[model samples]
Target: MLRQYELLERVRAYDPDADEALINRAYVFSMKAHGSQKRASGDPYYSHPIEVAGILTDLRLDDETIATAILHDTIEDTVATPEEVERLFGPNVARLVDGVTKLSKIEAQSENQRAAENLRKFLLAMSGDIRVLLVKLADRLHNMRTLHFIANAEKRRRIARETMDIYAPLAERIGMYEFMTEMQTLAFRELEPDAYQSISKRLEQLHKGGGDLIDRIGRGIRAHLEASGIEAQVQGREKHPYSIWRKMAERHVSFEQLSDVMAFRAIVGTEEDCYRTLGLIHGRWPMVPGRFKDFISTPKRNGYKSLHTSVIHDEQMRIEIQIRTGDMHAQAEHGLAAHWAYKEGKDEAARTQHPWISDLVEILDHAGSAEELLEHTRMAMYQDRIFAFTPKGELIQLPKGASPVDFAYAVHTDLGDQTVGAKVNGRVMPLRTPLDNGDQVEILVSKAQHPQPTWLNFVVTGKAKAKIRRFVKSKEREETIALGRKLFDEIVQRLPVPLGWEAIAEALRRLHLHDDDALMEAIALKRIDDVQVMEALLPGSAGKGQVKPPPQRQAISIKGLTPGVAFTLAECCHPIPGDRIVGLRREGTGIEVHAIGCDRLADGIDADWVDLAWGNESDGGTARLCIVIKNEPGSLAVITSILGNHGANIVSLDQKARDGSFHTFTLGLEVHDVPHLMRILAALRATEVVSTAERI
Candidate 1:
């Protein structure tokens, strides 16, 4: 733990105007609040907070941020209150500390839910003040560093996975590459111990074999730059084991296949010098094809700027290099924090430049569940970005595989909802076209246009998905309720007595629905049986103790589905009349009807389930048959003759096996109902050509 005087001196070194008294007081308050507390490592708990504070000092953060870091855990882990912290420190520090504090009151769903909710809260907090994120990142970093001290293996893995999935990516979003790299390294070690150990051992062996290789190359580059009359500082190091392993995984290559494992950086005095350095290096070596990225000219979405390239040196060695000015280097290292002012405490404008924080905050509102929030945010954070521009030259950044719908939403949510078509690079293009970097995109919208369920299949950005989903959900409910009303009138007309307002009101009460609309929706969604609704409207109206199965005239009718909405029978269950059925309703796809109790229904939990019954008037449908017949000459003729005699028409034919003396055929038969299909099976079984017969 950093001593009080030492921590103050470190802060003063960065900003002489830092409030020493405030820092001293926060240190004392945190220390006493955490007195006698111990961590899983059996270290004094105060050490954790102070260590986090020490980390902020390295970033040259302001006094208030450092103090917030020191007291961040006090509110959650100790008896110290936010009000008390505000009294001691100012409101800014107190708010920052509170933002970093984990929410203990979240209902326990699982670790994932808790992590997602916690992520949701801090993302909102970071929208107002980024210092909360900075402190939170530091806190996570320190905890990850000490994670091995925890005894429980499952608990350790959960924390490590959360850090890898959420925190590391978050750190990357802010351009805190060092923090992101360190956290990823630690998390990778815990998550994939064997892979981590193998990569580490390989790297160590390379280090032992190659003495001064990194230094020699770095000095050689600096010498070349000096000879070209350019002043520069060059850095060279092997890539971190995690970075190496990730590249291997992504490229599907082995360690022996990997080249350019070492990277060198040339930090120069000016932007011109940075480019000049790049020219000098490329002029001296054979530049690799398609292995160059000029982020300096077009910076990343996170404001990272650098010119990266890979070159083949004369030794048959492939090496990667990055060139940047000193300012660019600092910006690349510290990311958004580089412009965060520490001396004057005036970085609010810098914080405003990060619109992604607000975008994430907006996602918090529309996400359906905690897991969904995490999924969407991960989709937002963890992807290589493609930059597309509007016809008016406004830039829109989206994930690499983003379609025009994603581009429209990234530009504005309203535009996405109204998008009808798009033109990429002055030519008409499909809406599902994946955007390339620097492409000019024109979104064509009309007032009549609204989001379609089909767009969800192609859209990539989280914002587009959330907006499109909201529109779909709202439209689905409204349309479903309308369909319910139509069904309600049809069912009511069948009753012997008219459904008066009094009867309808009593039906809603008996069905535990809020109103007629709720009851209608329930009936339409198949949550309530039509017979049940009749019984509720008038006791015993559905007949005596038990409701009878649907007779031909009493079969339920399905009608009024939206024009584009399709209803199809599920292939898995081969459902027929007299079998209970339900429809799995997924947006952009048909309502797939499945037999009740089919194993496939379990996987459709994410899809909407609607109870369905056959219409009173209908044509015959197909039922599948599995048959085994002797593979003799004229055996096929006997099967066709038997089918013709039984009045069963083969709709489709698929043979499963033709081994030796037997042929196993899977056939779809046109039939009126289950009993009619059973008769065909009996007829086939009675013949010697058909050794065995059964419904599939």
Candidate 2:
């Protein structure tokens, strides 16, 4: 544990303007607040906060961030309140401590929910001041470092999994490679003891066998750079066990098959030298094709820059090399920490300008549940990135394997909603086409088009899927409300006396609904039927008119039309089970139902109309298929054979048109829904004698 004065001196050494008195007060206050409490490791609880504070000093964070780290657990595990912390430490430290405190207080029924709630709170705070995430990460790092001290194996593994799934990705997002790597290693050990041990033993054996190999390789790389008039410092080492293990698992390769396990870094003085060093190395050694990347030209979203390549050294050993300037090296290792370290004179507003932060906030608004937020945020955080561009040259960074729909969503939600087609590099492509690095994408959108539920099948980004789901859900709710309102009106008209909104409000409690909207939505969704609503509205009235279905057969029931309203399906368009049909009442003529989009409906027949839908019991309907086939006896037989094989019962068949060698026929068949009709059509189209097949 760091002493009060040592912690203060450490902060002062890096930040001369750090508040000494503030640090001392925080250090003493945390220790006193913890009192006699001890960690699972049997050390004084205060020691944990002190160690976390020490870690923040290594990042060279501001004084408030460091102080917040010291007092993060005060409100969570102790009697100390946020009000008291604010009175003692001022608002800045109090706010950060409050953020961390909220993250700790979220308890849920399941482990997944708990993690999601905690992450939700953390992200909310992170949006305000990224320092909240910084302090929380430091706290998580210290806990991970002492994780083995915890006695329960299951508890330790759960903590390790959460750390791996959430915290480590966050650290990497903020550009803290050092913390990310160490946290991953610690978690990997707890989660996969056997694999971790095997890899650890292999690394140790390699280290012993290749005595001074790292040194010799470093010297040779340095000598080569110097010989080419490039002054660079070369460092080499074996990759981390977790990284090596991941490579083996991903490629399904044995340890012996891994050639580029050893990596070297050449720290140069200038950006120009970084690339020159890359060229010189590639010129000297046989370069591994498709293994080089130049991040110096286009840095990562976190602002990391480097030149990476794999080369064959000594004509046998394949090694990976990275070249970067000194400043780039610091940022690559520390990420956001390095950004803050030298952020003097630069506007503080620049710190919170990360595009992902706003994206997280948007996700919070759009996510429907804690699990959804967790899944979407994880998808957003963890991905190998690829950079695409708009036709206007604006850069759009996306996860590798992302489709154009993902690209459209990244541009704007409206664009994604209205997207109908896409062009990749001036050539029209399918909407599901995966975007490649540096490709220019132009999305073609139309106001008439909205996100299709099928878009969820191929979109890789959470943002696109979230927006699409929200839209689809909203549209469904609107349609459901419309149907429910029509049903409610019809039910009321059948009553002894007409009921109003107050009557429905009175019935809400009996039906276990939240409010009128919920009740109506339920009615629209068919979860609650006309009989149930009438029973709720007028007690014992439902049993009077309810006609129980006969035992042997299931029959379709209409809800919005009164019991004796008498409705007939219009024959002009042949409204089916899946079609949106509406009820039209004419004077003394009961009612006529027509598909909403039917050309017959466009005739503007004047009548009292109500929205209608087929109930869940409505199983089968007839559909008409207009198909073209060769005008031969065997062709008609083949068509009939295909329909019978697909279980379509043909109701009627008529020859609509004929040519020299082909005939057009309109056939009516009983189908379950639009999908059944589509399958039948597809099967007919696949037949050798059929020229075309389409739904009428």
Candidate 3:
């Protein structure tokens, strides 16, 4: 732990204007506050906060940030209160301390829920001042470093998982690569001990066998660069074990197959030299195909910039190289902290501004559930991103494979809802077309356009999907409320006086509903029946105003099956809208629709049969098709696209059989009628992989 005077001197070293008295007060106050407390590591608890403060000093953060770090735990672990902190240190430091405090008192639904809720609160707090997140991250880092002393294995793993899942990604999102990498390394060690130990052992053996190989590689690179008239500082080190293990898992390759285990960095004096150094390095070695990325030309969303490349040296050894200027190297190492180092005492609004932070704020407002907030924020933070542009040249960073709909949503919710089509790079493209780096996207909008259920099929971003779902849900609720209101009015048509919104409001208490809208929506969804609604409006009037039911079933209402029409059973395999039907009339029974292949019509001498077809009243009717498609990449997408083109929506698809060459899919489609179904089948049959497509 840093001593009081030593910590102040370090702070003053970077931030010469840092408030020494404020730092001294916080340091002494925290020590006294945690007077008798001991951490699981059997050290004075104040040491943890002091260490956290020391970590922040390395970033050259403002004095208040460092003070917040020192007093972060005082509110949570000690009897010290935010009010007291405010009285002593002012509201800014108190608020920062309060923001870092954990939500241990709130009763949560589950452990996952607890985590999600905590993240939601933390995000909300951090949005006001990013310093909160910085202090919290420092605290978590110190805790992770001392995690081994916890003794409880389960508790340790839980902390490690949370660190890996949430904190590491957040650090990375903020461009804190050093923090992200170290946290990931520590968590990976705890989560996969066996793999970690095995990799560590292998690394140790390699180091023992190769005497100073890293230093040798560094010297060789430095000499090569100097010979080419490029003065540079070159350094080499082995990749982290977790990074190596991840590559092995993703590529399904053994450790022996991995060649580029060591990474080297070349820090040049200027940006021009960074590229010049890259050209010279490539000239000396055989370049590895498809192993280069020019981040300098297109910086990451987090503002990370470098020229990354891989080369095969000495005809066998593969090595990864990074070339950047000294300033770029510093920014890459410290990330957002780099900005603070140059701009001291910048206000929260200026300091906290970031695309990812803006996205998190949007998510905090729009996410449907605690789990969803957690999920979307995780996706927003962790995914490898690609940059796409609007026609106006505004950059939109999205996860790789994000579709145009994701682009539209990232632009604005209104634009996404009104999007009817899109043009990528001046060419009309499919909505599911994956955007690449620098592709200019123009979303075509129409007043008639609204988010379709199918948009969810292709959108990859959490923000896009969440907004789409919210729109669909809100629209459904509005429609259901309207329907319920219509149903309620019909029920009250014969009443003494018409049941109005005012009357419903009065009866809400008796109906066990919150408000008029709640009652109406419930009635619309049939959760609360019409009779119950009528009775609640006028007490003891359940049957008085209710119309008596007809002797027979008034009208066969199967929601979407029959829009507003009445239908009788078609016994010939129950010919519904999708099946080919023939009407048959028995002696006294009404016209009955029968399927063409009904067994009852074949043997039995049935009544006279008449040709029948589904009426125009039908909106969507079920149709069955037997499809044989080759088992290959995108086969299913092709079939679905064909159907979608012909205005068919797949209700369900079941696999009947599969061979190495071909697979049979039994698909149920919600189509207009038999003719519409035939059109879909025709399109499917015309597809290349589709060997056979016929109505079943």
Candidate 4:
């Protein structure tokens, strides 16, 4: 039971005119709202919110942020209203509470969706103030710290997976390195307990004397800086447990391979002092080649600016050193929140100052669907970013493994829609080429070229997928509309009445369809019958309630066809069940059924053909027949006309070209009887360019 005065005192250290009355009111309201509620650990639920507030206070968040933290869990876990929060605190506090509250009520169908939705909500809230996410992150950190109280292994793993996938990366994106490392370590411990323990034990054993070593290094760096009259604060920090485990897995190395497990941060007062400290450190130790990064000049997208270098402290020892000014250090730890003071002022001015903040807000606003919003949020907030450059040298930050297609889309939807090809570092590369750090990319655009379905297979970023989908759908809609107009024209030409587009639109709307394009696309796919549209246009149509006529069955069966007998239709000459069929009874269960002109039998079977007659009843079946026809337009129409005249049903028809100006159609059809089938085959054989008509 921590007192409200104590909390206010801590908050007042950061915000001089800290609202004690408001803080106490929130504390009392939260206490009442969470009355008799308990956590998984069976502690008073109020304690959780207190801890969350304490976390925000440590971050030196403003009074409103601290108040919001107190009320964050109230709406979710207790009977508290956003209105009440707004009345008690303000709209800002209420919005934060509402943001956190929405995340608690999302009922995703699967664990993956659950995680994605949570991340989406977090991002939406963060995009608004950025403080909401900071509070939420603090909340998650506390939950993770006490996760062991939850007995279920599956629940534990789910929480851990969500933390790893969303929270940890988000922490990194915002430059909360300490929180990110802590969350990752906890998540890794839960997700892969055995591996975590193995690596953690090794790290502990290896760094047995690490505390003293870190103290000595810190002191030495501080003394060297002081001697050089450079004001700086140097502190040593070890790599988190999860980081070590990840390094081992990524590099496929044992713990011993990781030499620079501990790092020293040199915090100075000015940018010049930072560089001076870096020089002094380099002069003291041999700097490792290709191991230095100057983020000061080119700050990270998250506003993290620092200079990093790795060096060998001794012949056998490697260490990392980070040099940054006090402002840079604050920016590194607090990220976008450092700009909170500016944001709290004039709204228009705030938007102009941090335009990227507004970009984030727009991303939240213009997200068309929940899934898309979730995907964009994850990529933008919770993934490792690769910083690439446009040909103009403007830096673009994208998720790791983002393709040139992603970059094209990031530049503009119109550019992405027109992108035909891309060049990386002056070399022509595929659109799917992955960007690396510091690489310059140039996208080639063409109005003639459009996105292909295959682009979805490689594009990694959500924005790229959304733009491609939008472009493709727009083109498809246009094409379908055109096709629909053409189809309508053909329909009107063939019909007696002059039907207009509105009438067709009405008919389609009756079928629960929205527009002409949808109806036209359905017609093109053969999903909607052309005759159905004609019937709809005509008044009191007889075909409206009519069902498809069942195939007329021929009552003919082969005699002496025993049950449990296996029979095969000859490929050389296929026999339909309705065709005049003859069965050759072999010595065993294997029997051969064929149409009269089976070429294999004409050549003569290896065994003697037995005299078998047909029964009166014929089973419903189809036979394969190959027909040769003149390769000309409407040749298929002529063939279909012949079948329709005979009332023969064509099941499947496949045609392939035999040579120049000649084609072969392998026809599958149902005939009423053997005589009917025979007559049809005879008629096909007599047709022009009919090289052969055989049952096969």
lDDT of 3 by residue, 1-696 (tens): 689988998988877777899999999999999999999999999999999999988888888989999998898788998899999999989877876774323222356544434444445446446677788788888888998999999988988987887678768766788998999999999999999999999888888887898888889889999998999999888899999999999999989899889999999988899889999999989899999999899987667889999998863689999999987887788776765552554444454433344332333333345344333323334235665666544546677789999999999989998998899877999898998755778999998988876788889988899988887667666655654565465556635555666677767887788976888677645565655776788766666544544232221222332221122444325345656665553443334556778776765365544444554455555667789999999999998888878877787899999888999988877777666767777787787989999776
Q: Return the lDDT, model 4, position 210.
A: 58
For residues 41-128, write the lDDT of model 4, one tens digit per residue: 9999898888888877777777778888888888877778778889888897888778777655652346744544455444544544
Give residue 625's lDDT in candidate 2 (0 to 100).
83
For each of the candidates, the C-alpha root-mean-square deviation to the true structure, in angstroms, is 22.5, 24.3, 24.2, 23.4
Candidate 1 lDDT over residue span 1-696, tens digit each: 678888888888878888888888988998899999999999899999899989888888888888888898889878999899998898988877776774323312486454434444445445346677788788889999999999999988988987887678767776788899999999999999999999999988887888888898888999999998998899999998899999998999999799978899999988888888889999999999999999988977666889999999765789999999887787777765565537455445444444343232333233345444333333344236655666544445566799989998988888988999999977899999999855778889998999988888988788898998898777777777776675576566657666676898888788889977777667656777677888898787788644433332332344434323335677888777656777776644546777797899999977766667766434556788899999999998999998898888898888899999999999888887777888888889999898899987
Per-candidate clashes come to 0, 0, 0, 13
Instruction: Give the C-alpha miss distance for residue 343 in model 4, angstroms.
Output: 11
How much lDDT does each candidate structure score? Answer: 0.77, 0.77, 0.75, 0.71
Candidate 3 local Cα displacement, residue 426, angstroms = 40
Name the weakest run of 10 consecutive residues (lDDT summed) in model 3: 557-566
**Per-residue CA lDDT of candidate 2, range 295-375, in tens?**
889877666689999999983799999999998898888876765552453446555443333232333233345334333
Clashing pairs in 3: none
Q: Please provide TM-scores, in order, for all candidate models, with all chains considered together.
A: 0.55, 0.57, 0.56, 0.55
Following a full C-alpha superposition, what root-mean-square deviation does model 3 have from the true structure?
Answer: 24.2
Candidate 4: regions farther than 4 A off: 107-109, 125-128, 341-696
